[model samples]
Target: MADSQRTSEPINIVHQDEIWKAHVKLEKDSAEVWPRKWGFLTDIYKEYKMESVKMKETLKVGLPSHEVVPSLTTLQKHNHVGPSPPVPQTTQALIGWRSGHAHLQLEKYSTVHHGRRSFLKELGWPFDACY
Candidate 1:
């Protein structure tokens, strides 16, 4: 593949329930099926299969942006993917870049730790999510 990449139009993610279902259904083997790319989210949702088996694996990637992570309420506003019940206030603030966008535990991912790695450098984001 060529090194050049394109950004495509920003995804105004509506239909939260449908989109979330697709994300949750992304299996462990999806990395192979999807193949990692500059736009990581694109690597998901192609040729999705129904899995009768439950998955225990966690697929976490670092945050993506030349922008910063939205605030909890901001995420709620922008993402439109509200929780079934109210989320804890404690986890609210952490619901920004790494935790929200990357879909990982706070400890498992960090802009300071992972984002600065050379491969991720080009995916620029604001300093707010930095450690």
Candidate 2:
């Protein structure tokens, strides 16, 4: 019994020693890794702050100030000589040149796809037969 207890005590002590070593190794690794991660994050944050400041400075220098730019009423008075032309009430005028181009494209698509379907109709086939 004395010999058996002595053998079992050494095994338990070795197991406890292994668990203590693992705990210490984990603490040391955590201590080593976190500082490097925090340092890298700090550097990135500093760079971002510097870039933001540079962008703000560039914007401040590039954009015209309120005092330098002419107001809307001042521009209107200078541009118009006498009476202004009447504004058109049509939707085409409101949409401008893009509307004319869109209308022409629609007409072309209809002529190609819908207007030329008579051949398929005469042959007793579906309109999408070619497709």
Candidate 3:
């Protein structure tokens, strides 16, 4: 091939060493800044814990300790019902709605991961077209 059209050669050992050194320096700099960058998250977590404690105290005062929380079986007994009529139109409509919502969520995820389809497929997504 002509020199102008030739592909570039791989980096030499000296150049690779320099690149490694630069990467190490960059990593060290980032490590130094990482704590400062994420320090607010720690503060926020502390505030959240304090607020949760205050809420728990408020709840304890407002609600009776004898109140019985509903069991899952009780809730399921009240909520579970017989299967719906096997109406083709209604089934298709519900599937469409669910697929549309799933697609929208996948679009948002794709902006970050750029592998939403493969990720969903790996998770064994039921609706192939949604991803």
lDDT of 3 by residue, 1-131 (tens): 57547667654789879999999999999989988999899899999999999999888765455787778998998864454444446665666453354333435445554444565667787666583
lDDT of each: 0.52, 0.73, 0.71
- Backbone clashes for every candidate come to 0, 0, 0
Candidate that beats the other on TM-score, 1 or 3, i.e. the better one: 3
Which window of 10 residues has the lowest lDDT sum in candidate 1?
47-56
Q: Of 2 and 3, which scores higher on lDDT?
A: 2
**Model 2 per-residue lDDT tens digits across residues 1-131:** 77766854446778889999999999999989997777788888999999999999888765467658888999998764443344568866765434345433435445554455488899999889997
Residue 50, model 2: Cα distance from true site in angstroms: 1.5
- For each candidate, give its TM-score against the true structure: 0.13, 0.24, 0.36
Model 1 residue runs over 4 Å out of place are 1-14, 28-131
> Could you tell me the TM-score of candidate 2?
0.24
* TM-score between model 1 and native: 0.13
Q: Best candidate, TM-score-wise? A: 3
Per-residue lDDT value at 121 in model 1: 50
